[model samples]
Target: MDTVITVTGEQSANDLGVTLPHEHLIIDASIWVPDGPELTAIQRRKLEESVSMENLWWLAAYGRQPKWNSLDNRRLDDVETAKREAMRFVAEGGETLVDVTPMSPGLGRDPGALKRIANHTGLNVVAGTGHYVRHAHPPRIDDQSASEIADEMVGDIVDGIDGTGVRAGVIGEIGATNGFSDHPNEKTVFRAAAIAQQRTGAPITIHPPVHYKEGHDVLDVLEEAGANLTNVILGHLDGAMELDNASAYYDSLAERGVSLEFDTFGRIGYIASEDVCFPLDETRIRELRRLFDKGYGDQLLVSHDICKKNQLTKYAGHGYDYILRDIVPRLRRREFSETEITSLLVDNPARALTIEE
Candidate 1:
């Protein structure tokens, strides 16, 4: 099967050069709001009430539901803005932007959207397929068989989604929550992703449930699925980078010829703010040196997993700019050779996203 699907004349993965293995142009959790007629007042209130939580003082604590306009900046679906952002990143030396927007419940699927954005932005955009986790999957997925899910994913890759000619270049951000042992859905999702990888030959990237035990479980599933471990990437390892855990994860995956991705570089306060950590200062440099010493440097890929629209508000002050400006120079100051730094930013990612013609 042909892995590359052209949309709006942009080249596919095989043509994308110096790719950032993980990143997004536009993404919204609200995109998962099921499509239908507008919700009634009573129904809307009931839905809001269910997600509302109470604090110790009995104050209603609502989770930060993103202000759709605020989070997306009203330009996510706009081609002009996407073009500017992509051009800026490319001008700054980025070649490809891997959109890991997996197929999930409530999230509207638009495989052709990337093609439109890429055509406007002049950035090589690679879209993804495969279901997320149980929380993100439509309720009906709970009762579906593994083969059923796998077949659906294969359809997304082989058959163009929504009757659009665009097809997925990758198979994840497959969500694995907690340990794979206890969670049946995580295992199911993993199995489905593995099947997608085997069928498509596109690289698979896993969003492991946690940073440790569950992460190992994801690797186990990928191995069993016959995914070319060399082409797989274990993402979100930065959350574990503070300790020797990053080394352990990288070394384990490296031994299997897989890549290790540390993409949450600039997203300091979002997502796992309390639990998520960055290896900046001497700590980051030391870790890089340690990985290089262990012969694992070639497998490391770095980026800022900026998913929110607010993240891209400023050109040079946001997104990958944070890493290219702040982090890269700091690593150099700490005696990380320019050659090594280039390999991490340019070479390693290029290899990870590269697919044979």
Candidate 2:
């Protein structure tokens, strides 16, 4: 049987134009580090991994300790604010924005909040289901079996989250840390996510474990789950997009009919600070061209992955807006055809999100 699955009473993929397959409008701030100093040394160490320990120690000692209060007024759950921000995107020639926030305790998992935001914004908003990384999942989940987690995930898609009667439109941002290749938690989450996909036919989007190995591991989980690989998306591919490694990863996933996502288009500063150096110039166009030349154009999706509030200002001059204002024109300048560009920003995302007419 053909593996492509469709959403109920939704528009066809063609209707989703210039869509951003991965993004965040309103994300709960608690996921980064809950507001508390009671955490042990290990907890402090783990949370500070993204930042330099020297910088953190400096802040802890001489500088004011970084508090979560900076994030207090950044809620996107309000319909009016969401509408304004989303309007900025659509006015800039963007169409759909997939709100890939997962439900976790202390994190705002309000499906009603999403619905209200979408309704007010007039943006085609896609919501997601599934747990985040092991650290983000609720303590209660440890008491449940994989089957139980799968059942809950399926219910969230088919029914509604927390019995609120609001259905999630997609199945992930399912968190796997360190990429799928090495994490045991990734395997468990993959099993549950796979079971959920099999039952609901909701397309899966991976929050790939940190590096390339995780991407490979995610594919392993999907295949094991009897998922149609084409219905799966390997997210954060750009994070590992060294020329040789990216080509191989894209080729492998494309051959399996899975889509590859380079959704961190506007995160240059944050991503640059990481150990790995991401090529921020024409490297994006070069990568796209290489994928097109390799005949994988139809399976590529692009976006900014703007999770933090600061990224919005970071976007004002050079963020998500950069994709529309800068990158598209650059691709055109490089002689990329409109069809290829469309497939990357629109067609592929619609297919992965499984929006049906």
**TM-score (all chains, Cα) for each model:** 0.78, 0.81
Off by over 4 Å in 2: 1-9, 33-79, 179-182, 242-244, 269-274, 314-320, 355-357
Root-mean-square deviation per candidate = 6.6, 5.7
Model 1 segments more than 4 A misplaced: 1-15, 30-79, 210-213, 243-246, 269-282, 315-317
How big is the positional error of residue 287 in model 2, measured in Å on the Cα after superposition?
0.7
Candidate topping lDDT? 2
